[model samples]
Target: MMNTYSFPLSTLGLPNLMIQTSDGKRPVNISEIVFLESARNYTFAYLTDGSRVITSKTIGIFESPFAKHGFIRINKSIIANLSYITESCKNEGYAIRLLNGQWHTCSRRRTSKVKKVIKQLKTL
Candidate 1:
């Protein structure tokens, strides 16, 4: 089972994430994040503004927290924000297009889960 951590600023009524930066931790609104890509032990956070932030933590560490905020692990190395997904491409493969026009293919093993989550999101 994956471990889950409560967002630190929840009590303060802020949906923000204290992401680790080179200098220290910085607060970023979760809604501003579009996706997260893993790079070995590090993870890259792509924001809606087209900016990227690198954190020195494994992607796994973020899986649970992000999930609670509507982010889904579309594949082994990527966790995408559901709100940022603009389209689903079924003709080519199990892929999704983000607001930034970047396409990410879901792994075969994760395609079912991704589809289910997308369906659920559409209902809300």
Candidate 2:
């Protein structure tokens, strides 16, 4: 079973995600998360500082909450932060490179939406 934390917002007034660790629940700033990967029933949050936080919650649970924070479901197993996306690999078929140099491919069904989002991000 997973432990839950009551706090919904961080000190910065941004949403906080409670990450389950060995010690206890740790609140992480939504903006600091660069990407998320699903592993069976668990989800791994990859932060900007090269750290990873594991939570027992399914990745689907984070989709809506993270959308407002600039996260997009790039693929079935990966949700990427738009701010962390460095480049879009058009030659590689809807692949995007994150700040950590990790690449994630967008699923066929999501390709159009991903492209539109990337295009908008590039303009800003």
CA RMSD of each candidate after superposition? 7.6, 9.2
Relative to the unseen true structure, what is the C-alpha lDDT of residue 62 in candidate 2, on a scale of 0 to 100? 91
lDDT of 1 by residue, 5-77 (tens): 1222222443888998997999899888889999999999998899999999999999998888778998999
Give Cα distance to truth, residue 79, candidate 2, Å.
Answer: 0.5
Residue pairs in candidate 2 whose N, alpha carbon or C atoms collide under 3 angstroms: none
Put down candidate 2 lDDT per residue, 1-124, tens digits, no spaces.
1111121223366677778886799999888898999998999999989999998889999999888777899889999988777767766577888888887889999999988877766555
Q: Mark the 10 consecutive residues where model 2 has the least summed lDDT.
A: 1-10
C-alpha lDDT score of every prediction, in listed order: 0.83, 0.81
How displaced is residue 28 in candidate 1, in Å?
A: 0.7
Output the lDDT of residue 62, model 1: 92
| TM-score (all chains, Cα) for each model | 0.85, 0.85
